[model samples]
Target: MSTAMAPEPVDNGGDARTRRSIARAVLANPTMVTFGALAVIILAFSALAPGLFTQGSNFVQLAQNVAILTVVSVGTTFVIITAGVDLSIPSGIVLGQVFAVQALKLLPLGEGTTAFDATANQTTALSVLVAVTAALLGGLIIGLINGVVVAYLRVPPLLATLGTLGAGLGVALILQDGVNSATYALDPVGNGALIAGIPNLIPIALVVVIAGFVLLHLSVFGRHTYAIGSNPEAARRVGINVERHLLKVYVLGGVASGLAGFLSLSYFSTTSIGGFSTANLQAITAVALGGTSLFGGVGSIIGTLIGVWIPAVLKNGFIITGVQPYWQDVAVGFVLIAAVWFDQLRRRSRDRG
Candidate 1:
């Protein structure tokens, strides 16, 4: 009875398998890492400036602050997923704003009256709608041209967008007669808070993000985008119209940029020619930081959502903590580098496995 019983067998293989499965899951969803980092940053900021960072008003401000960037980043996400770069986003935003404002100024709402003049020839709602439509059309035309050049003409995306960037800015400048700033009487409506101290920009941004998620994750167009990005030849072999799909992706990006322009015009009640110079860089950086691969074929809209907020939170937190504005750029640069490095490491790990 006292004899030693047989030792229970160790389930080393099972344990190892479980561990591998967990690792695979983590690797498959890189957003987990970005989300974790965002949480940490928030916590750190809260700790650094407890009263300031934790305030309800500050959070609302942060939401309104990042609204424009979030909208633009959604479009940038699509282009990046296709392994294409668009340098024209900033120009697109400017164009949209300029177009909207110019339409309000030039379009004959009534006899010898423009939307800006408030002559009562047209209802405020109709004027806003018409101007918004014109802004969107401006963006659409630019996007279509970019897509045509890149997809059908076999031009590189970077070159095509860069060319458009210059051209778009020139057009916007011409429309404004080289004026650095232009304002409209509807500034209050455009930038006013709609609900609970939240600016109208927030709701518009939410709609864009939601629509982008649906388009990217739940639509056939999204599937083709991923396929084309992953392997164009394979996608072509499968009868996927690669060129047409690419064109659509660019157009979508353009539309998003246009939407952002409208929002910006509303929020600021003014269009500044040089105000959004850094917009393209910020959008691309946010996309990359959100776990979207610059090499294409791997991306997530949810990740982009989180990515757009991180920099915004950082800048806000830094200001509260008395950190210099320039340092924010430095911090963002490091984060960008770290994100790319992580991507490289992940790629290497997959290759080895």
Candidate 2:
């Protein structure tokens, strides 16, 4: 003790502070954290279902399966980023598909009486375009009505969309005359393969994602959207037209759903009323999982892209591993819960810092 000086300080506090800083940085960006989670899931599935999960064909199939949902989720992302929810997405999608098919039927292009005739040479490219346009118009009308109800009438988004959800389904059923299925001779968007074995749907979805990213990240409208979601009163005080913006957001959502309907028709060649039973839940779950806070104002399209794939991979993995279909829902439920929990934690940490 007499010969030795006191041991130098270990500086353990400094190291601990550094570690805390790293953790906070990682948590600050939900997209990064979600990507990490997605990577872990992929690795786990690769191990559990080694052959099929990682195969090229399986990847293509996964892309095809998720394309419609991805398109629909884009709209959901827009609505959610503004601190709003649209329960009408599923209905919007179904209505869009049904309307497209009916348009083809009513405006047959050639010698066929029904749009579903394989022998009919009636499906011209122009007819397809017109049918798709009509479907999109229907979606726009529905979205506009929702906007008016929520913005002008001051109804909450949930209740307003909930009413529209039922109305949409009712309208779809009436259009199809309660038919369980309807077919069309529209050209298949999936008939050709692109580079890396990716189908046309992949490119189409990429366009949607890129467009959405630009709209939300690079445009003034995106800024206003964030402002409103972060605080409506404050946004208004700053000269943001909250009602008009909300209306536009809803309408955008509708257009997206309509596009998804077109994609669905291309992929499946038929519109089944029961096929989209879980679509609304899936789109919402994807958006939530992508790290977009339900509370609004903070979100990313890149995150939504990752989120859409998570469920697609999960379902495909489960099916490959012989897991029951119901377990897929269970797994998705857990993912949603975990996402919300992490979101709350991040908010709290931000406040503390």
Candidate 3:
């Protein structure tokens, strides 16, 4: 009887049924879920303060406020998809601004002097170009450092980037001390236009986001990146150039950071060294919270865009609603943790099967 019983514990239908259930759940409309959340937030805001929520001025302000963070978050989505983190973004942004300002100070400030006064600086576009270039270069250099440290030195991304975070902060401080600079005034000439009605920076951000989406979703290189992140050893076994591709991804992230910094300079008209550490962390959290698996290879630009904006929207909404500013931070922290926890649960369930 025992031998007969042991002969076969044959195919049970249980596993197949469980798999079907999971497949069905996964196939449900995710877009509706995202949109629903956005709607709830909008409705909540509008109900609380109809005028603030509906005003055109408020809408424009929100757009301008989110632009920098949205751009940075877009770049970070690429890195996190590869199961990596970039902690140096804040520093990179600060350094770019500093470098850009200093470059402007050096270029023909006056006939005999080495620095430009407020009047001279206010009228020139050259300084803006120089500043933007410096920002881009600074970001590229930081990204390369990140790649070299992670890919070659075998440093963990978290630890390596943390080191860069500190180093970058130090560099920013040095630049700040060296310059003894004051605020840069925004140039009013052609303020209402770009090369046309659309600002150059807006077009630049759109192009970056669109091109990044295309590269990540539609290109063979994107597939290879996902393959590498999903399983590095397997990717290499299939002859994917893992190291080179990773380096490129890191550099691209840096370039994105640099561009974000440039936009920020335009937005603020002044560089503040003290108030951006949180910005970098928030961008990372936004990417992670947007349903992008921290384990890698499962996220989208559209999701990241949603993730980035939700927090910005929430903060802006709170300000409009007279919620204590500190509460916004607490709320964001909770949202980030909750999202990560949910993601973990999802991953575990998938693994169990």
Candidate 4:
């Protein structure tokens, strides 16, 4: 019997065309469209409220106001990239503030008693630093629990974080009721300056945002996050330790949340039981608005920063333009819905193509 020669492999010319078509379709997605729309709105508002929105002092306030939100949103970006939702971040932040404040009062200081009279500038500075450290530690511990439950125990992300959310809120409430010193306020200050116009929180927030973006965008840890989020099985099969990477991701998130909490304290100066209830949601919304996929993988810290700023800018502008405070929240809700819708459109177009 004569063996027939093996047929030569056929090269299809359709693959490149299909890819280009898909690329064009994705570019038309709602997320990209809304980002452009939001930019227009910001510019329009800036133009209309030139006196109020474009002022130097208003810019400073904007920076300070959005700082905490930006920090928390960065953490959410990491969690979401892993196809996880961390509802516990707000509670963790609140407790961090509470513990940090408590630590300040209880910790020893130079020639000071357990009860500190924060009247002196030097003592005040030291206390604030101590408070920041305490908050950071609190976030780290909670993050560790979150990572352990999800990674080792194979618990669902929502349930794991939900448990921590309730637990953390309870802890904050306990701190408020037990410590009586929960209402202390921070005084804004300039360091013995003859002439100066700057809010200290603005610098801190800038630093946090830039540093977080760098770590998440430029580091190996960040690359691993994308790898796991995009394909857990493939990442593992390639020798990437998924469990360990997950733990580190959650830990970094916790640290970011802690820093956010400390910053919140600086802005509000008091830790209330009801505080930050909507913060986690807001952070998630910001992350989503910035084009981060809720289904895992794909995200941008720069986009998050812009997303955080837009809402804050709109809110501030609305207040200045005499709109009812309640209307501002309503407007933000509408914008968030539009953004999600856009993201959905993008995903569908990409999938279809």
Please report the candidate that would top TM-score against the real structure.
1
For candidate 4, what is the lDDT? 0.76
Best by lDDT: 1
Off by over 4 Å in 2: 1-23, 112-122, 194-196
Q: Which window of ten consecutive residues has the lowest lDDT sum in model 4?
A: 186-195
Clash count, predicted structure 4: 2
Candidate 3 structure quality by residue, lDDT tens digits, 1-353? 67775676553678987788666675332323444566688789989999977687676556556667777888788888888888888877777667766766677766654323445245556666776788788778888888888877878888887888788778878877844344353333212345454444555566777887899999997898788778989999989888888888888777778777666765566676766777778888778757777788777777777777677778888988998767777877887787777677667667753
lDDT of 2 by residue, 1-353 (tens): 64367676444678788799778787788888888888998999899988888998898888877888898898889899888898888778888888888777776545656554532244566666766797797678779988999988989999998999889889989988988454546655544455667788888888999999999999999988888888999989988889999999999998888888877876677776667767777888889899998899999899999999987788888889898867877888888898989999888877753
Q: For model 1, which pairs clash?
A: 190-266
Q: Whole-model Cα lDDT per candidate?
A: 0.84, 0.82, 0.72, 0.76
Q: Model 1: per-residue lDDT, tens digit, 237-301?
A: 98998999999989888878887887787777788678888898999999999999988888899
Per-residue lDDT, model 2, residue 116, is 48
The lDDT-based order of candidates, best leading, equals 1, 2, 4, 3
lDDT of model 1 at residue 61? 85
| lDDT of candidate model 3 versus the reference | 0.72
TM-scores for all candidates? 0.90, 0.89, 0.83, 0.84
Q: For each candidate in turn, give its C-alpha RMSD to the true structure in angstroms.
A: 6.6, 7.4, 8.2, 7.3
Q: Which residue pairs clash in candidate 4? A: 30-342, 31-342
**Candidate 1 global TM-score:** 0.90
